[model samples]
Target: MYSRSNNGARSHRWTATLVMGQVLLWSCAAEAEKLPHNLQIHGFASQSWLMSSDNNVFGKSSSGSGSFDFRELGLNASMRPLPRLQFSAQMLSRWAGKGSEGNIRLDYGFIDYTVFSGETSQFGIRLGRMKNPLGFYNDTRDVPFTRPSILLPQSIYFDRTRKLALAADGVHLYGERRSEMGDISFQAGVARPLVRGDEAEAAVFGQLVQGHLAPEMSYIGRVNYELDGGRIRFAASATQLNMSYSPGEGSIHFVPVIFSAQYNAERWSLTSEYAFRNLQYKNFGAMPDMDISGESYYFQGVYRLTPEWEAIARYDVLYMDSNDRQGRKWAASGTGDGRHAHNRFAKDITVGLRWNITPEFMLRAEYHHVNGTGWLSTLDNPNPADMSQRWDLFSILGSFRF
Candidate 1:
């Protein structure tokens, strides 16, 4: 838990950083406008307000005035000095509940060199801090303009442990092939995963511990296929993330595999994804080694009322322990009181509206009817017994970009 004084200090720092970043981004954009087409710069800012009927999210959202503690700001630039080589980087500041403190940090920076290029195929390599191509959205989830709704399907995204999966320092090999049948692209990487924040530790152990989670060598890969120029698409991605706890806590390994599919039409689109997560914990103090498997999936549909307006609906589900979906076994084993059953699973129904007021500005509103608290952040809602089995969340956001 964080003290009120600490929260205040963090908020102040975030405000100062936001102002400085805005000024810098605008100045760079103004200068880039006069530069060659090889150089590009962009930035975005979003502010969100959320209110919940039960279980706090992104702050004390269940209370009066809800929470204005959610926001995101980002700036990025890319330069292609040569036809086959490019450099790109982004800086991001995000504030969300107690887990993220709105600190500005390097989101990604990388150098890309293409080894070969032809009319039908290309091969390349990238080295530096790069985003893990875990799913269709992980690479671009930070930008509000690219997200389908205010909040992504938590079942697969797991914002609680985002830092561990966000980006890594590594090298990636990529290739693409285009033919009359369709287009196929693949990317694979080996790197040291990022585990700086305490969020990943708290998520695995149920609370913040005395030790830290250290980064370890990991691997990630993805394969994507597009037919009829993206009218239909399919993707499969997986990653193995390794970490160790200091002071002799233990070793932890997380492996997750996802399958995704999407269909696009003139006015409507459909998307779905399924994920299986495997977690292993070994050599803990006196506790026996453990292995747990989790499952998640969601189906979503979007309809474009107009070029500037859209409507979205989705059903998302999550199970913390596939073997004990109802939590009867875990609850009976003395993990907690009977109320803990609801913590094992979650089912969410969501509806949202998006208004692209202009190419550079947008507004969004969404509502969620959720059952179970399986995905709630422990840092945000400390008292598990006080959590409600059913809850409601309403959110609104405004975003501007250049």
Candidate 2:
């Protein structure tokens, strides 16, 4: 670990870098305003009050203590550099007061090409940092105000890369088709998993050992069908597991499957999802390996009492197949990571509120009680606790976008 002095240095460095980015963004926006024709630029910003706590119970529990948590900042911009094409990017800055944090990082940046048409789904390719559309939520992640819970479904798949995972250098093919049942769409691409830029490896990043969950190459595909009444989504992807996952570096493959179901109307709505992973290696070796598998499911109901107010409650659970025949192959080979690395499960319950202040802004609040192994099923575990289920979190956010 870096010395205490280095901690301050790193924080200072990030602050400086963040300031520089802000300056550039603002300068360009002002300059663009002077241009003529269709030149337009727009963006939004938001902040929150976060709280997390648990009563420190043991074994199993349904809910946890709640306390003040972290704060978040986000900015998004769209520039019409040309009449037929549009460009956009978003950035996020987060902090955990009193010196606790995951780290400073980049959120996303990508360019889009749109074809003008009313009856057809246009062709577009987004290049730069890209979202891994393993499921429904991953694609709609940027719009926080549109979600039910304050925190996302950490159980199914929340890769460190972004929401579950992100990729560099990718091309996406997408189109929309409509039917009496609903509107259908699809996207597929290839990308390099780069979640471990400079961070320490988890003693066990979930089922993964001490290597990247994403491989040198990964393939992604997704489908969504929506009707006036409800929607259904499915997604799948495969990546080459790192050597630690496969004794022989010759070759390896891992597939992840995700499913989501959601229903919404003016008065009420519900949503749920499940995700699983399977790993296989090319060579038959004596090295210990695990075919780690995980399952996550949740149900939520929301009642919009009035145009300006709403209430919601949700239950979520996550479990791993680490004890299964091939589960051992996925355990990390080290012992210095976070708790939940060796455990088989984690679960939680969340309650939330949404209030509309005006057409341009909204506020959200949430409370959660975490249990079991107490880590995200979709993420690598750096610390493996004694298999206790006692953690808590709370958050409130204010946002606006168009």
Candidate 3:
């Protein structure tokens, strides 16, 4: 169990860190004006309102008047004191229903040192907490301007498991080669995955456990190829994640592989990604050991109506267990009550429009027609039986950045 006093102290410390970081950034900026070094500061804030016809998301979206429980605020600073050395850090506070309570925390802080730099190629290493290069959007998922829509395709970027895939504390080695044909880059890291609170626990175990989940050493890597100055792109990423449960000697291991591709044209762009995940559980006293394989994919297209207006359409799908895509075997086994087959799979059709009012401000709205509850948050909708098999979600957001 977690103590309130301890939680409060942690929160205070995190807030203090953010404050101190901001102060340091200002100090660096002042000093940089006197020297040749460079310091850059950037930040963004966004608010969203969501309403659903028959489900809850980021609060009681289905309730009267809808919900305004979704918001994100972030600030970051980067300093280059030497030609081949750089330091960067970001502080973020995000609020999204019960899973995230808008706590201020260090998102990523790292020291990057270039081992070799030349006209056509470079090699470097980064130490400290850094974002995992899982997919194209995972590195910048929190930034609304970088996302294709209000919400990312849930099939690939499961918001419920965001914390788990966000960032890690360790070292990463990166290298890039450029030529007339295109550019090729790769990044690999060995770190400890961040597992906190009950969000990841519930997502993995289907419910919160009495024992705690402890992070273990893990590995992640990605490779990218781009042609025609990013008019076309391809990437492959993979991760081996491990965790342990205390007081009962339980363990978990999962491996996920993702493939991403995109094409950019003058007026339109197309994007797609596919992922395969294999999970294993062992040594739980009451739960039987098991292995599960899952699959997810999405196809998306965006068309620019004008210099400041855009439209998007996408179809996404998620299957929790590929072996039992319909979940007939698991539901028939009677593992628990309200275990419907539809809960194992989800299909979503989405459409949205984006309007850029100014260089630093924007607004967008989107609608989703979804079938199945596979990706719904268990926290917001505690009772599975109460969830509708088919539902609609409408959302609008406004964002500002500098």
In model 3, residue pairs whose N, Cα or C atoms come closer than 3 Å (at least 3 residues apart or on different chains), thus clashing, are none
Question: How many Å off is the CA of 171 in candidate 2?
Answer: 1.0
The 0-to-1 C-alpha lDDT of every candidate, in the order given, reads 0.89, 0.54, 0.88
Model 3 residue 33 distance off true place after TM-score fit, in angstroms: 9.7
Tens-place lDDT digits, model 3, residues 1-402: 321223455566457545655654565455546644487777777889999998799989999689998888788879999989999999888878767767777899999999999999999999999999998999999889999999999988988888888899999999999999999999998999888786787677666667789999999999999999999999999999999989878999989999999999999999999999999999997779989999999999999999999999999999999999877887888874657887888999999999999998999999999998899887777777678889999999999777
Listed in order, each prediction's TM-score against the native is 0.96, 0.73, 0.92
Better of 2 and 3 by TM-score: 3
The sequence of per-residue lDDT tens digits that candidate 2 reaches over residues 1-402 is 221223555567457546745754684567556755544444444555654443321111113432232344455556776755666666555443222232445566677776543563555566767666766566555556655655676676442334335444466666677667677777777765553422212313333343343345666777777776354433343333232233345344556677777777768877777767665544435544445565667777888989999999888776666353222333454432443343555677888889988876889988877765534322222234533356676677887654
What ranges in model 3 sit over 4 Å off? 1-37
Q: List model 1 lDDT by residue over 318-340, tens digit each.
A: 99899999877888887654458
Model 3 TM-score, all chains together? 0.92
Off by over 4 Å in 1: 1-5, 28-33, 336-339
